[model samples]
Target: MKGATMKTTMEKLGIIASYSRPRVSNDNPFSEALFRTCKYRPDWPTKGFATKDDAQAWVKSFTGWYNEEHLHSAIRFVTPAARHAGHDRATLANRASLYANARSQNPERWSGKTRNWQPAGAVWLNPETEISAPEIRDAA
Candidate 1:
């Protein structure tokens, strides 16, 4: 396998390789955001895990916190678990009502409209180009 390149191996296996454009940040935003969130966590070990078991334990704990407790900004500050369990609607509605009440009490405090608490419509990891949709629709 020393001289076997990825392209050659893929060709032999009948797998087509479709690569992203160089330096395109949108290509893997979800994964990139997750890594950033994990690395920037306050409890991330600076000294590194002493053993594989320690690392695994830490990862398990982190996963629990991330999915169950952390309020994701992109998803309107609701926990992933709540979103998965179909609870985000009520949570976001409660927040929106609270904000509206506060705004009504002190109109001067807010200069503009309250934060948009609308649920995120569609999330894409590697979204298609804007032109692709129209082209596909026209073709169809």
Candidate 2:
């Protein structure tokens, strides 16, 4: 009601989004979880920008990475792309098959012992999920 009177003075305006008649905070738990994730992400750049363009660019980058590369363990560690494409399950199956085939093809390629291969020697790839590699390839 007060918003109608001060419409001219408003710095920003948005629709009065309303939820179904549930006073429980659980009704909006998803949004709360999102804010929690945003605040907790170590890489979330929080410093204000001098110009709007800078703010827009940062938002753009964050959106791209969030939607493309971020993996949610709740969603089976698959990127949003895989989930959107409805191929998350298929993609996972393919990856598993590839691993099995690779191991079967050349057991010597991967030593019997597990190798520490995160930053250097070897790497895993995911093609279906935007979090995945652009292309699946042998571990470097």
Model 1 weakest lDDT span, ten residues long? 129-138
lDDT of candidate model 2 versus the reference: 0.58
TM-score result, candidate 2:
0.46
Candidate 1 per-residue lDDT over residues 1-140, each given as its tens digit: 33448666655554434466655965556677788888888999889999999999989999999999999887999988999898999999999999999999999999999999978676544455433434543543
| Number of the top-ranking candidate, with TM-score as the measure | 1
Q: What's model 1's TM-score?
A: 0.72
Which candidate gets the maximum lDDT versus the true structure?
1
Candidate 2 residue spans exceeding 4 A from truth:
1-24, 95-140
Residue 18 local lDDT, model 2 = 40
Per-model TM values vs. the true structure: 0.72, 0.46
| For model 2, the run of ten residues with the poorest summed lDDT | 131-140
Error at 106, model 1, angstroms: 0.6
Show how many residue pairs clash in every candidate, following the order shown. Answer: 0, 1
